[model samples]
Target: MDLSALFSLMGKVALITGASKGIGLSIAEIFAAAGAKVVISSRKQDALDEMAGQLRARGYEVTGIACNVGNMADLEDLVKKTVDLYGTIDILVNNAASNPVFGPVHDTSLEAYDKIMEVNVKAPFHLMKLCFPYLRESSNASVINISSIGGISPEPGLGIYSVSKAALISMTKVFAKEWGDHKIRVNAICPGLIKTKFSEALWSNDKIMAHMMKALAIKRVGTSEEIGAAALYLASPASSYTTGTVLTADGGFTI
Candidate 1:
């Protein structure tokens, strides 16, 4: 098998959300390195510009756009600016997510639940809808939704977030099945205990880490780059025949 041919993202246009840092940043870097024209988005323009500059310095084609995923107007503007820059999007990574409250579901207020669902679930769904026309134009379009192991098995103090992720997973399958005729592949990634700022609360806690280690076969927190590699597989031609698949990359934590 020609591995390079399978994985190369040359000439492809990729848009990644929440890409200023963490897993999103890792995915953007990897995709850019793989030859994709990468457009990274987050809530802050300064952070995006800094990251974009660093990637450009490394000889990667990258552009940064600031967007708050929770806002409908922002989502539309994000798509517009990306297409204006790159013509069309061949890959879309829905990595932006929110979990303002980290407690029991019973304690989660309606406001908190709305915020979580809006950012984690609704935003991805809306963005996909916005990108559908352009995605259908690409011969090898792929959509990756970043979910969580919490969506599969609920974790303590993260109830509403888990629910939103589960919805995202389901949304992936639904879009995959519906868009198959359009040749637009949709998939979800469920990561477990990655060592990112978004997950520092869990990994940094001695008690949580100790408990997680007992169940984790690898006995260590996964890295953002690890998840980036997984996203690469899904976005590249390597996963051309794969869609509606929930790939779990949690260092055997799910096992």
Candidate 2:
């Protein structure tokens, strides 16, 4: 088998949300390196522009579009601007997420719960719908949702976030089944204890780190780059036959 050819994303256009840092940025970097025209999105324009400029300097076709996924208008503009630039979207990655409250599920406020769902679940749902037309037109369309292991097994202090992620997982399956006819593949990735700012609360704590290390088969925290590679596989032709799948890159923490 031609490995390079299998994983190649040449001539593809990918729109990735929350891509200014961490897992999202890693995925954008990998995709661009694989020859995809990448559009990275986040809330801050400066951050997105800086990252996009850096990638472009590396000889990749990259653009930055700032968007707050929680806002429907922002999402609409995101899709519009992306399509206006690239003409089509071959891969869509819903990586932007929020978990404002870090306490018991019962302790979370209604406002926090709404924010969590809006960003983590609703944003992805709406973005997919907006991109459906372009995605369906692509010869190899793929959607990769950045879910979490918490969605599979809820962790303490991240209750509402876990619920949102679980909802995302279900949404991935739903889209996969519904869009299969159009040859659009939808899949979810469940990363565990990644060393990202979003997960700093867990990985930065000595007590939590010690407990996590004991459970992880890899014996250490996972990296954003590792999750990026997993996403590359799902986005590339290598995973053409894969859809409605939950790919776990948790370093065996679930074991």
Candidate 3:
């Protein structure tokens, strides 16, 4: 088999959320590097616009849009803009998520709990539904849901946040089965502790970092680029036969 064919993402158009920085931004950059036109969306227009400029300057096709995933109308606008600019969205990366509250589940307020579920689970669901038409229109459409390793193995202080990720795992399966008929592959990537702003509280603490490192097979935290490469494989024709699967890029943290 030609391995190069498996890694190429050329000619594809990808729409990624929470793409201003961290894993989302890394995924968008990698996709653009692979010759895919990428549209990045986030809550902050300034950040998105800045990143878009950097990518565009590098000769990659990229654009930025402001979108708050929890808002359905904003999500619809995001999709509409993508279609207007790119014609169709061949790849959809549901990377936008939030964990506003941490600590015990019982101590967490209803408002915080609801917000976590809304951003992590509901937003992705809505995006998929809204993008279904464009996705089905593609000859080789792919949907990537960003989940957490905590979903499979709950953490001590991450109660509601972990629960939401668990829902995402289940959601991935449901969508993959439902969308398979359209030949739109759906998959999830469960990233371990990465050195990103989203996970700074965990990885930045010396004590917590030490404990996490002990459990990791690689003896280190994973990087955003690592997850980006995995996403590229799934989005590309490399894994055409793959669907309804979760690729754990946790550096053996689960093991």
lDDT of 1 at 211: 95
Residue 140 displacement (Å), model 2: 0.4
| Clashes per candidate, residues 3 or more apart or on different chains | 0, 0, 0
Per-prediction TM-score: 0.99, 0.99, 0.98
List model 2 lDDT by residue over 32-146, tens digit each. Answer: 9999999999999999999999999999999999999999999999999998998999999999999899878899999999999999999999999999999999999999999
Q: What is the C-alpha local distance difference test score of each model?
A: 0.96, 0.96, 0.93
lDDT measured at residue 203 in model 2 versus the true structure, 0 to 100: 88
Question: Which whole-number lDDT from 0 to 100 does residue 49 have in model 1?
Answer: 98
Residue 16 lDDT in model 1? 97
Off by over 4 Å in 2: none
lDDT of 2 at 69: 99
- Score candidate 1 by lDDT: 0.96
Q: lDDT tens digits, residues 154-204, model 3? A: 876788889999999999999999999999999999999988999987987
Among all windows of 10 consecutive residues in model 3, the one with the lowest summed lDDT is 2-11
CA RMSD per model (angstroms):
0.6, 0.7, 1.0
